[model samples]
Target chain A: MTIQPAFQCERLCIDLPGAPGVRRIIEDLDLEVGRGQFVSILGGSGTGKTTLLRALAGLTSHSSGRAVYEGREVRSPVPGMAMVFQDYAHALLMWRTVRRNVALGVEGRLRNGELDQKVQNAIRMVGLERFRDEYPWRLSGGMQQRVQIARALAMEPSALLMDEPFGALDAMTKASLQDQLLAVQAETGATVLFVTHDIEEAIYLSNTIILLKGSPAHIARRITVDLPRPRDQIVTKELPEYLRLRHQLFEAFRHEIHA
Target chain B: MMTAVNAPAPAVAGGKERPWIFHAADNVWSALQGLLPLIALLLLWQMLGDSRSPYFPPPSTWAAALIDRTNSGDLIPAVLVTLQSVAAALILATSLGVGIGGLIGASPALARCLGPTLEFLRTLPPPTIVPVAALIIGVNETMKLFVIVFAALWPVLLNTTLGVRSLHPTLLEAARSLQLGVVARMTKIFLPALLPSILTGVRVAAPLAIIVSLLAEMLTLMPGLGALLLMAQRNFNAAEVFGLLTVVGSFGFILNAALAAFESWALMPQGRT
Candidate 1:
């Protein structure tokens, strides 16, 4: 059986205006993400990874081509799509309570009672029920990131786009959040397109990985993970298959650099 | 499950005291701190004045005159007039300054184009325009209001613009994503974000407002505390001059304290730091 693409970027190009003229950031980029699939886009710094995410989120305009959601061309962010920004501090509104921040996404869409229920559920899902009434600034970094996740989940988007959500975290926090994200994705059955530079994180959390190379990014390689659900980090990292896949990805990345 | 990090042992001498009381104590302490210099100046003035000199009245003579004026309602009307000018000018300045500042802050091109001109306007000494304002308005209440507005507007306007411009982009993005309507966005995001800076500006401008209003009154001779001081100066009644000075000082303290109180309540509903 052939899987249909949930998100498709066709010949998308981005132009960033400069002093002289408009400079091209990304060109002739095409990508696909399948439904309910956890896809990781791995790229080095300045490879237009963030610009691509911004275009997908409809925050940045593309100079040419289309980003299609399901089969429809996406001109702007629709209700079925939500994004998690890289900066946890910037992700949630500091002036608002955790519940209010989470409820912010679905404002005007749901009634007060329904919104409260949804917010509660999302907070509970992220294990932030106790901190629902606290402001974002008062919480620890990991807790704040969880609140960001809760906010995205509360939006109830069919697809969640994360831009290096755990990059700012320490190793332990990053590992924990990775597990939490995997669990959230599994429970909600929401398709996720997460961008990361960490190869191990991509391998452990993603079902499919697409590696983008250089400026005006092109797909350098793609890998598929056949790992079972509820994968243990320690056990999985020790597995020969995981090590072999890691080595293969490392080689591909090095080859792209040399090329 | 990190008990040490999440939940620490309570270290307390006492607990369950009213948090509001501590806030009140803090306010009182700061108020006393502000008043200390004024009190020292008053003591020095008293020491410099000999009891025999008519030109330099002693503190006791000034105190007696202040009490006499208060009892006889001699300075009441003058105080009221000064208060009226301050109220009018403050209302006009805040409304105009905040509105104009917000407009300028929101538009980068406009701010850049107009910044130098605005800076030049601010640099023009407010008192220099008093003569022009007096001539235009014919030594009426309008002249006083204009001078007060002229003096007070710049600080509020500049601070408000800085506040608005410095607003965090993430907060704006959050507001946009939340679909907060225009009015809601302004009130919740812009207004609240601009408030602390606005308060600082207003506090700085409050004394200037009083000073300008008093000066305008003195020039116009329109029955204000400043005019009363001018009358005392002309008659060489040092006691009355010192008395009125005391009243002005008290009024300044009251207005500043009132602003501080309002700021405390408005900006921080959950215990000010």
Candidate 2:
């Protein structure tokens, strides 16, 4: 029998307390994410992209319908799933060293030696082994973001929910981190639901890009990226298919904005 | 390897290491500069004052009186008693403040409910309650401790509450997502984040702890430096009074310096450069 999808959101709706009564954020949204698949949710500003991600992570409750994780209703954060937030500085414990921060998720669950190895592997995956003893606050923004990712990775979750994790970094750092994230996913085979507004970044990193449109948003299009694996930043962008997909997304975004 | 280390490296002397004695000398020089005016006034008073003056006794007279106290059996024990009360009160205040502060800070409804009564209690001067406390609790070590804790707890509680309120929302989310249990949340997350602020509160409260304990001792006449100082004044022993004042001032100075050193070390970021 085929395994169930990692997450399924069925007719999910969410509302937020606004200045003018309660405002609807997500309406009648349905989505299914397969295990080990890389998907990026792309949207414009104020389109409830984050609200959807939060609902899936079980951080924010839905007004109606359901968000299902591994065939169970998700009303709160569940085991075997971890979230990497955008604000690395705030997300990380500032007082903890890189090694300790990475260990935060899985520290008490495993034995001391097992926990140490998991933390070490995660640090090595993010290339933060050299600065293991240094506190998170002392690291640069890119390094700090890596510390957060490593923290999530150490949990060894079946699925990773990331919300604009690399949005705060400069171009060089963002590109490098994207490649590192792809490699990490390949190794762990964890399903990823990444949320971002950057068109090029979504196309580069995801196997499928879900373009979100309109207020109280639902997915407007889900485009599968059939590009070759072991993707190179320079070579992949130069590919005609990659260029076509990039153009297609830009056009979609432009058309949606005008509408 | 394109490992770009963007963080600023910590400052080091770069060449041969300077001897620690030189650093010590620099600190001593600065401290001496700070004390110069007081030293000058004391020296002038010692040179100009009459030996048998009823008032305005010189530093020499104060020193003689201090030596006399040392020879007597009462001085050391009184100081020890005062120190004990201050230490106990401070310990109690810190624990109670952090415990209650964390709860109130985490819950908006709790803070709102307790805010009025706490504000009212906070406003009533601690010393003003001492007599009232003595009447109710009776003048003993327990009453003394209660008075000092009441006086010292406000700073720590206020600081810890402020610390908790300012905590990053994402940190709690991170903790929750990690499936960290309640005990782990407090020990690992809350305590570490609130530490610097707690230390700040304790620093402010330390002086209050010492002062209030002394006040309680004086009011009760329960055998401490406070009582000794009052007794000396009542007997018109000007020299003894001056000596005791100097002793208290020295204790305050040393306590403050020790706390500052501890706070600096505790807050020092590890593995810089």
Best by DockQ: 2
lDDT for residue B239 in candidate 2, whole number 0-100: 91
Model 1: TM-score for chain B = 0.85
* Backbone-clash count (model 1): 0
Q: Over 4 Å off in model 1, which ranges? A: A1-4, A18-21, A70-76, A255-259, B1-21, B37-49, B137-139, B264-272
- TM-score for chain B of each model, two decimals: 0.85, 0.87
DockQ of every model listed? 0.38, 0.61
| lDDT score for candidate 2 against the true structure | 0.88
Query: Residue B225 lDDT in model 2?
Result: 90
The regions of model 2 sitting more than 4 angstroms off are A1-3, A255-259, B1-33, B270-273
lDDT of 2 by residue, B49-156 (tens): 986887888889999998899899878998899888888998999999999998899899999999999999999988898999999999889999999999899999
How well does candidate 2 score on lDDT at residue B170? 91
